[model samples]
Target: MDTMRDRFAPVVSRILDEDPRVAVVLAEIGLVPFLEAQRRHPDRVINVGIREQLLVGAGAGLALAGMRPVLHTFASFLVERPFEQVKLDFGHQGLGGVLVSAGASYDVSGGGFTHMAPGDVALLDTLDGWSVQVPGHPDEAEVLLRQAIGAGDERVYVRLSVQANREALPVDGQHLLTVREGRRGVVVAVGPLLDQVLAATEGLDVSVLYATTVRPFDAAGLRRAVGASAADVVLVEPYLAGTSTGAANDALADVPHRVLGLGVGRRELRRYGSVDEHVAAHGLDAASLRERISGFLDVGVPGVPA
Candidate 1:
């Protein structure tokens, strides 16, 4: 039976096949798939040794030279180690390419702290031309990948779970996916986590916005989504709380809103597990989301009918 990871591998592989100018700079853990693609299409893959900093720097250099580079690595190593390189070389120059950070947010089991930290989008939130995208599922991931590739100027960060996630109906990076109609409150889910928002709204009426792109956020779409609904707005993300989601939410603060951000608290290197396990441990499950949004609505608009 095909699993979630199975669904994702092919899409990236497809990109590899179609773009002769593209080379995948992948980590040891990320090697197998790209290697397989190369086996099928010899002379396509570029294996940059496991050095995270070198991987990111080389990717930026490749983009500068007009070749598309897909830099793949574990999330922690990708964002944390060579952040300066990404910020200075990629973001500063407004280079285009996909930074595929696998094991995004503890998705890989036993991958260790070196592998897991729910990526904090804040790291790139301030870089001038960098945009962050966390896809909700297979369809979203594919669409976002194409959009990022086409988005030539900005440094696009495509973050996804190492495994396949429940696929939501396809949504454009430009269109916000609505989870509910009559809004009692708006919960803007970050990525594949849209499933949790859907579950949270089972018996209640609330608005849900699925953000495919955190930076270069679909502002017009968001303004319209929130404007149509009379409710408080909250942003949810896998990053450190009060960082990317909060910053993103604050950018829209003029909309008469109250915002709440979600993420794994900051720490050295502690827990190790799959993304699902980490989410459950951090109270990020469907029930938790439902309860939290409900509470936010209650506090924001007293006596609002469910």
Candidate 2:
């Protein structure tokens, strides 16, 4: 019911008002809102300039000194650049801090390839005690952000999409928003694309499941839900499907899991282009996703060996 800015503004305002030890760190473009919030309450914010490495490193240092730090940065800069600091300083030392990575995936359309961090989801998993989340919408982002701040963990990355397009889904971690009662197969959507999958279920008896949490999935709950469905399970993610947690759903459940890997194909980091074109080229667009679903449905499951 609340707007994205509305959801974030109040919490940030409250934190600034009460938590004197709470400091906000912004990296480059992520500084847009941090600066605005700082203007509103100039005394409380801490701008880390464009040094993303130092930005994370500083957050680690601040947390080590018993201060609460909320660090904001683009997904690529926040995850890829200061990875050593994040792993060694935070994960190893067990520092307490929140790293809010904004504009994940195609959200960085205008920012080009250099600004977009495709490897973050895969990279974050390498750390031992990190909590990684990718919220489909702004409202979900708000809830996850609140959770991350209060988690009191060494590291947490709330991967956020740029556009606030879809309305917030009832995040009960149930059915991922029921699409349609179908006999064919269940389409599991990872993020914002749940809307498109729902739309594609017009004539088909399709069910859509939104797997919101990447790392800590509710396996027992998911198994119960998918077990109730007659169709096979198809897991879809915004990025490459198999390499990330999207693929792990197969191992987590007994259902016949079909992982749909989306996003750009891995290659030499030679090409240069904005994020939108890159995603589109990789078949991450709405039409491409729909086509993939249709193909999956048409192909059906191959006869399994007895």
Candidate 3:
């Protein structure tokens, strides 16, 4: 299966060919894949060397000039390194652009902490009027990319990752899709973590909701999922833990609800390891998640007591 980054290149290339207003700005991180697109649309596809700030500034400038800019780079460089430019050039200036980031969380675990961006989503949450999409599969990535490009002057962020599920879920860029139903609680799985979340909650009496677009928080869908009963929500994101717990609380502010936000922890792991190792260390793998989820929900495991 093609990784999300692999699918991104061809989709953006086709968009550049078909849409004249679309422009892609790179910072020499993922340049190889966009080489052909650059050759065809020299002015539209730009490379700003390793200058991460300039990459965002240039993209914001293009947006200011009535062009739709798609900024590409690793998550750390795209959002963390050039965050000031992102805030002022785009948010403060009220410009609209698409910020597409590769290397989600520990996708590039071998590259060490410099390449990991476990707080990318949480950092972006500080800004207003930005739509964030975390696609679990390449096909879903293509859909969300098209929607972001055609958003017409709306600020958008598309997070691409090497991790993916076995199949694509029908994500419409808005609202959550119900994958399983139960009366006890609801488990909200974000992006690539859906498969692991499903396996963790196997046979557990809880509903599972799949989320691709998380910026808006899908408050209404979450409320509907919990229904009129006192709610218990476990948000399984691929980013910083408790990143969206506040949002979840706000969504159910009027009702009685308890939320458990699980994801990449804040502690820095100095040793570089494989992605699976990173997942295990963060307690995001199936086995760890099963224990955590059951403990939080007060639901007994098949062979264990609550």
TM-score, one value per model: 0.86, 0.80, 0.98
Question: Following a full C-alpha superposition, what root-mean-square deviation does model 3 have from the true structure?
Answer: 1.0
* lDDT per residue (tens digit) for residues 1-306 in model 1: 243345455776887778677767765656776668879766556676778888888888888888887777777888878889888878778777778776766776485776665644666676676677777676667777777766655577888774444765676666567767655666777776677766766666666777777777776666677773333766766656555555546556676666677656565335565567777776678777767777767633345433
Residue by residue across 1-306, what tens digits does model 2's lDDT show?
444434554566567677667777776654555556688667457776789888888888878778778887777788888899888878888787888776576465565667767678778877776666666777777777776776655467777765443677656422244545666666666765566556544455556667667665555545555564333556666655554445445445455555545544665234555655665676656666667776766632335211
Note the Cα lDDT for every prediction shown.
0.69, 0.64, 0.94
List the RMSD of every prediction in angstroms.
3.3, 4.9, 1.0
Rank list by lDDT: 3, 1, 2
The count of backbone overlaps in candidate 1 is 5
**Top model by lDDT, which number?**
3
Clashes of 3: 0
lDDT of 2: 0.64
lDDT per residue (tens digit) for residues 67-140 in model 3:
99999999999999999999999999999999999999999999989999999999999999999999999999
What lDDT is obtained when candidate 1 is compared to the true structure? Answer: 0.69
Off by over 4 Å in 1: 1-9, 39-43, 162-165, 228-231, 244-251, 267-274, 299-306
